[model samples]
Target: MRKRIIIFDDDKDTRTICSLILEGLNFEVITQENCIDILRILDLHTPHVILIDNHLPGMKGAAGIRLVKESPRHKHIPVVFFTGTNNAQALADEAGADFVLPKPVDLARLEEVIELAINS
Candidate 1:
């Protein structure tokens, strides 16, 4: 079965591009505009991985990551931070994210991260 991924980003273009790239790489991608009801979404889909932007609308991506990590049921799912932030790696580490992809996202790196996350 194709691995599933849930992506959250406020930028429509980012969401679209990532979705297309992941879909092309054989992942089942679900895109969300914000982190609202993230737990609900995770529970509903149970995706293998999640990609979140650090600069979301209401809640910051790090905070959203924390929320996911705090949840006992969904905490094991890998969460990756894909953002333009210069300190993306540090932020992701602080937020308990399994990985970080700096934007403008490198397709190769994205693919590698997803594969690593899924296999780890």
Candidate 2:
């Protein structure tokens, strides 16, 4: 079965591009504009990996990551912090993400990180 990845990003372009790229890589991609119902989403999708943006409409990525991390059922899923901040790494570390991807995204790096997160 193809591995599934969930991307929570507010930007339409980013989500579209990422969905396309990941789909091309033989991944099943699911995109959402916000993580308002993160745990519910996780339960529904059961993604292999999660890519979340820092600035979201309702719940921030860090908070959502925390929820996932705290959940025994979902804690094992690797999370990639996707941000455009200068302190991306620090923010990701604080958020307990397994990896970080900055925007505007570097395609090769995005692919590499996703692979690592999936394998991890």
Candidate 3:
């Protein structure tokens, strides 16, 4: 079965581009504009990984990542924080994210991170 990935980003272009890239890599991708429905989505579809933008509409991506890591059902799933900030890696680490990827995402790096998340 193809690995599934859930992505949360407010930018339509980012979401679309990431989804397309992930799909091309044989990953089933689900895109969300915010973190509001994360629990619902997780309950329905257990994605292998989650990619969240640091700045979101409702909650900060770091907080969202914390929530996911706190949840018993979803805690095991790896999370990657995507941001344009210089401290993206530190923010992700503070939030308990498994990985971090800079915005204007490099497709090759994205693939490497996803593979590492899945394998580890």
Best by TM-score: 2
Question: For candidate 2, lDDT tens digit of each residue in 1-120?
Answer: 999999999999999999999999999999999999999999999999999998999888988998899999999999999899899898888878999888889999999999999889
lDDT of 1 by residue, 1-120 (tens): 999999999999888888999999899999888897899999899999999999988889999999999999999999988899888888889989998889988989988999999998
* C-alpha root-mean-square deviation, candidate 2: 0.7
Pairs of residues at least 3 apart in sequence or in different chains that clash in candidate 3: none
Kindly give the stretch of ten consecutive residues in candidate 3 with the minimal lDDT sum: 36-45
Per-candidate TM equals 0.95, 0.97, 0.95
Residues 5-101, candidate 3: write the lDDT tens digits: 9999999999998899999999999999999778888888889999999889988899999999999989999998989988998888889999889
- Give the residue spans of candidate 1 off by over 4 A: none
Q: Rate the local accuracy (lDDT) of all candidates.
A: 0.92, 0.94, 0.91
- What is the overall TM-score of model 1 with all chains considered together? 0.95
Q: Cα miss at 65, model 3 (Å)?
A: 0.2
| Stronger candidate by TM-score (2 vs 3) | 2
The TM-score between candidate 2 and the true structure equals 0.97
